[model samples]
Target: MLYGAAYYHEYQPYERLEQDIDLMKEMNLTVVRLGESTWYSWEPEDGVFKLDWMDRVIDAMHAADIKVIFGTPTYAIPPWMAKKHPEVMAQHHSGTYVPYGYRQNMNHAHPAFRYYAERVIRKLISHYASHPAIIGYQIDNETSSGQLHNPDVFQKFLWYLKDKYKTVDNLNEVWGLTYWSHRINEWDELWKPDGNSTPGYDLDWRRFQSQLVTDLLDWEAQIVREYARPDQFITQCFVGAYSRPEANVFDISKSLDIVAINPYHVTQSGLELDPQNDTDTIGPEWMTSRQDHVGVSQIFLNGDWARGAKEQNFLITELNANSIGGSSTNYPGYEGQLRQAVYTFISKGANMVAYWHWHTLHYGFETYWGGVLGHSLEKGRIGREFEQIGAELIAHSDILTDLSTQADVGFLYHEDSKYALSYMPALSQPGTGNPDPLTYERVFDNFYRMYFNVNAQTAIVHPEQEFEKYPLLVVPALYAADDALLERLVAYAKNGGHLLLTFRSGYGDEFARARWAVAPGILRDAVGASYQEYSNLMKEVLVKGEGLDLPEGAAATAWADGLELESAEALATYQHPHFGQFPAIVTKVVGKGRVTYCGTLPNMPLGEALAAWTMNKAGIDPVIEGLPTTVRVTSTTATSGERLLFFTNWSWTPQTLPAIPGGGKDLLANVSISESDTLELGAWDVKIIVQAK
Candidate 1:
């Protein structure tokens, strides 16, 4: 609802803060984030503190009437702590212990690590919890980018296994160590798993490691909760998904008040995958600029999906401040792209928006196009743009804060499945593994893309919940299934609820063991499909939409079941240029419920058709059109018992929309009307429209 930016105090000299604060106040900024890269600046010495300066900063923010969300300063351990307690060091993927060089360098699992971090957080939260200036507490900045290929994480895995299974005998049995010659008799004999002998080699262990990180995050959150006010929200910013280990990080982190994510949508220059490559030419198709935007949105969607399970609003904590890095060659998003990125979040129903930063590092503010506010006023064009959006948000605070919405579509974003898949090394490897890593990523991506294509209102729900809340449940290419989930979904379908599940959804147990009934498991009756060996479409399969004569291209392939149907049809078929027609997309009706299964991840347009088809079957309808791509609209009611709608335009471009037929006037520009023409949306725009009655 309000505009906010990550505030780094270490480098923000008094003069810079003055300029930034003045500019922010002029733009109607409501919140300011302090602490992130300021870890070292805050904790200069161990058992020593430096709030004399932070006090002044907080007082200044309060005087400006800006709400503050202070971040705990232990994200990056100070040099003093790292030097004194070497155990706090984070181990990277290649088995290298990284020194305290970058931010977020502390080992979350270390005992001494938690001790110091907890100490620092307790002091910081207690100081600011009651302060009139502080609105909330953000624990850390972008808690991602770990060298997961580490011995410390591996050792943590061993400890977790011992705690869960209670014995090495049990651990060995679950991992099939008897076949791999990787059996362990004594817990002490366990060394961190490598790419081969170690559980790190398995996808399940990777999942366990993700859980381990989540556990650490929980510990951090609990420590802060001990001192903070009960009403004040708590959140930790998470980076977009980069790997399987990071796939479910936010799902676990969603226990916080709001899930925060940083999205650096891609630009023409490309990404920083290789620290060495500095060429102008793009490297690979995956390494291109557009893919970067897709990847950013993908990660954001994953985080929001995880947050959906909490049934609470999520926030985009950090976005492109021109560039988040100090590189002179950083990718800069155009105002339009930034607008689109924000709109995507708004359309998806995010609660708040915050940019990466306020002031750029004059020393590190390299100008390939990254700094929001350069040292001088003349170069602060981006900052001015931010102010325009922020002022608009401030003008419409009530609708921004009080609005919430519910959707009819539920995506299968299971934390249990994501975690289990992460730790299974067999699944981490490609082909012939129980939770194949590539397969997991693709399966998740395909489902997300399809959901986004139609701006489908979605929530993340477990298979065990009452599906009556959701008219349609779309579970894509899942490789495992649990009996509890199977039974609940079965009941949901039979109860006249619409259930749209896909192939490979029900195949295995919680431990990645094959389920007894096979092929869509217990869902075979509801979907009219039974276990049959699936044939991967050799060539691209075409999914023909209703009326639109185009085929959507999807990746991971499979085909099963031609059920006896009262009302159903095969919408798509698999065909090689040489090999002929095999059914690809199939649908069937059971009870009052309908299930549609796609054998592959169809292209975006085709995926939209599938979603539209499901929507039609469920009787769901979209509210309005002609809104900016960045603006998301959700409806709720006020305490007065009036209908309220929240519209957030997450873009830099101006947008225009038609007035509501009756209710409240458009709150942003203060325009009053009874169904006027289009409403304008400036970049990073938000509007609240209430039912006037």
Candidate 2:
């Protein structure tokens, strides 16, 4: 339940450290992160450390009763390091160096960069380890900026392959490199990744790159742990890892304590939900998919991803204080939107909430990136919003901090599928013929949105985690999976679990090679259906059949699997000229469980109808009946054995809810609520009820 923002005393244009601290103290700010983005300020010259400069700021934080989370400022490099060793600069996949003008452009895989990074990290942590106000250390700004393609990095990748496969023959066999005479007799004959077209090479190369990034962070955590007390934690802030191609957040979380993310999204209209407003302001860089992207759902989806990273409560390391992105995208939350976003994060599993910074930078790359205080350095709407929000959090700290979010339906987040799909996408952008590299995210988001619409509490589970406990498992874009993983999924179906799968699933093996057998290679029997051919749609196709209560416009888009029934029943089929011969959706009962397959990506209404049908068959009902589309509800089991339910209104119009099934205490009002009494949520509002066990 900690609340505050990142403080950059060094970046402040004037000497207002005392004033800023006073304002924060007055606003009930609980904690502030310090010193993560300033390497040049920490060490202006090579071997010359200005370590004492941060001491006064830490003292001020302690005096004001606000805690601190210190960060190792290694994400950015000083000018001297780049000048001293130009090789430390990261070389991109295009054989060009990432220029020194930007942050996180250094090739941490390079030994020279590691040497200086380690030195600065150790120096920064040891200098302030004994400070009473410091609670933890953020290892790096983002675990990785992007993958490095340096010559040395490439050589290490070759060694990584050798260590993994043990022989060149094994590498050629697994990757199916014999195609087009691309098979190599020796590891030395392998071509550079820039000129390579093999899917196996691309998949394995991405894995090697992820390993390098993980190793660097693990190295940083080990160094920080040397000085960190048992009470203090070590974490790294990831800015929507899905957006960062090189970052493997679930794998990276294994090295640290908590998973933290920057859940930035469009506010105002972007948060609005309606069929007409679906794709209005969805920036290409926003958190969710452009199709039916509701801002609150996008944020909660990210929180679920973070919670699943380690299957524990996560931290909101950074979120919007004002308009999040660059200048043109300036649109902060309206009225109660900011507070609604906070509760949404908590409804998932956030233990802490912190903004990017305490005050807006007057001059810098983030100058327009507003903060609690704007350019005037005075508290405004942003400050007032957090003021009430912070007070509410402090009052409910006991129950809020000790709860674990509940999950109704689970989704598999496979890194291999994400990476492989990025390299070879299955769908193309509408109206534009360009290949959509974010094909994995598009399909994944669409499915997630579907479950969210049905009020099925979402849980993002990794492949290594146990998810068979959930009643329904929806897997989207499972395009590249090995036989072992696919076999486990089939077994899940046989064990009385309801499994939902979508197009392009099981088409490629782990190495991204198309299965020599028919489509859905290892899963055809368990799935009770098989598809030999698939096509990307140039136009939408109407689907009509059982379980699909469609409107006039309910149609399938993007890609379609020409599913031929074996032992499965057709749940839905395409209404097209020749493609109608194959089913678009199929289902079959296996052993005691059932398998449902979706052969095409459906539009919003169609997708929702499909989800409603699957959940009906799976016997997974909505948490609450008669809930509004603009209102979202989630619950967490408090340590005290009480169930805490959060109700959020995502629109500008206030909404009334149906009477509670059982009476509960409204913690916000400090009053008891009766089962017969209904509650009203204001525009962009939130309400939490504590129901006794």
Candidate 3:
């Protein structure tokens, strides 16, 4: 496991290379990332290049035994390139080109942009290809921030559709273009996606945009592979779904060697809000706090998603080393918060954890975004804490390396479903435009959190994945799906895999058209239940049941389906005035397996109960039973075949655990512990145990 920070030598106000290297040695930082945010300095002119300064920095770091990951620096275009080729700037939906000065604002498909991008990338690779310190390359910094909505991009989309559908009639039929008088007789008749009312066209447009972004990344990775050594890897730093929704991460990740993510947790103040409360009416304090909860969960969720993307261990290219600036609320770190954060990533099978930056920039756009070292370039609270984390990581590097997580529960996540549902606003809340946007992400997290509460290990499974490895599979709000995927789910369940499906699963086909058959379309047989109508709840509905562990009168909100069971038994019924006694939850048996359908969005308590019950029925066991809600436990297998258990206290209060079943040594504390020994963890603390072989 490598420990370090992204270094920006150009951002320094003075020469501190020697001092920084000494401090890095003290902190046990074995690696440093450079050249990502230095495009303007790298190529000040169109054809002129400066490599001496960066070469010196790499040489110095190599002398100190510090490996380097060189960035291609194509994310930020230089002023000369943009000024000379104005067509490279991304044209927005409003028909205006994005202005210069911001990163990721250029049209990735623009020939001029690609030409200049290739030049800089090739130049950098040629200069640093044989450098001993250069161990890897970060292709681009956070690809697909801006979507191109210009004529050129639209033409490319038309070409993509033409290639896929082969004929204009096929394209028109698949997109249901005749609904809005949008039937395209000629390819030129298709305009930019500004006011298209056809859901199929809108969904396809979004998908095409994702493809363009993937192509851009693939192009860059191909160029880098030409010069990168066999030992050197290539990756791109990916942001979460909160930003850059146009980029299909799974597609883009296929071109890289390993997945890299920029995982930033929400502030401390943000963690205080009610997790279930919507942020629309909440005050800044509550809103930020709620986002913190989402952010923390996303770190774990995205890590799993990234791991599943390539089915390999990933890296944290950028993690919060200090508080962020701007409109975001900044909160100081509590005791053990840093330790808990670092260990959490490792527990999820991350090979390395690197902070976003080394020192806070003295003057820049992110001037207030704190770092390991503050603007004063001195050790601060976070820096000191990181030093301790660095020491521990260096001490346990061999034991932690190659460790992989083992999860018995899998949640199905489909990016196309998210995109298709995004265009169908009628499925969301009424009266509010863009109502509860990010609902898909929230629903996913809510279900995952329920499993987390009981300390069940889970993985994110894509719809295309063969998830037979997991005994229990939870498919939540898969509003759009293809027949092949539905058939696969049915076969999985028929083969003795337990399946839990929530509202909106299998409602539409891949083309975003309502299924011609009964509701839940092809999945009706697998689920043994059908629904013709579902309401977006403006008020809470009560649920009563004995099937799961849900308490009577438990609240169900946000959405509810009027369900009718065909071969399934009603597990729970709605207590609403008009919807009374209607099946809100149902279960049926298929072959040797079981399928449960949740017809409404269950509250946290009910969700937890349902998850716990389903997991038990699937014969899945938690890492440690009877643990507090404030504590989280995850287990991974070490290279030596030893079982490693990670225990973390997320709360500010200290937590204690009863004697676990395994005798092991607490690697963090360097102390042996017996099976019957009681374990105690301080606030925000973390403990790792390697079970006796």
Clashes of each: 37, 0, 2
Error of 2 at 203 (Å): 0.6
Which candidate would rank higher by TM-score, 1 or 2?
2
Candidates by lDDT, descending order: 2, 3, 1
lDDT of 1 by residue, 610-649 (tens): 7777787788876565544545565554435556555654
Model 2 lDDT tens row, 574-602: 89998889888889998888989998888
Which of the predicted structures, 2 or 3, would earn the higher TM-score when compared with the native? Answer: 2
Task: List model 3 lDDT by residue over 1-693, tens digit each.
Answer: 988999988889999999999988987888899998878888999889998989889999999999899998888888888889988888877479899988888887888988888999999998898998998999888888466797788888888888988999998888777775778889888777776778888788888888888988899999999999999999988875333688877788889999888777664533322333223322235334344236345556766776777778888888778776553545555657777778888888889888878998878688767788987898877878988998999899998887789899999888877877676743344334346555666677777777776777888877656688799999878877888888888888889999999888888888888888878888888788887887787767878774765765476767888888889988877777878747888898999898898888777677778888898889988778788767778899988989999988766667789788977999989999999998998867789989965
Q: Alpha carbon lDDT of residue 583, candidate 1?
A: 50
lDDT for predicted candidate 2 compared with the true structure: 0.85
Using all chains and alpha carbons, the TM-scores for the candidates as numbered come to 0.81, 0.97, 0.96
Regions of model 2 farther than 4 Å from truth: 241-243, 275-279, 282-294
What is the C-alpha local distance difference test score of candidate 1?
0.60
Colliding residue pairs in candidate 2: none
**Candidate 3 versus the native: TM-score?**
0.96
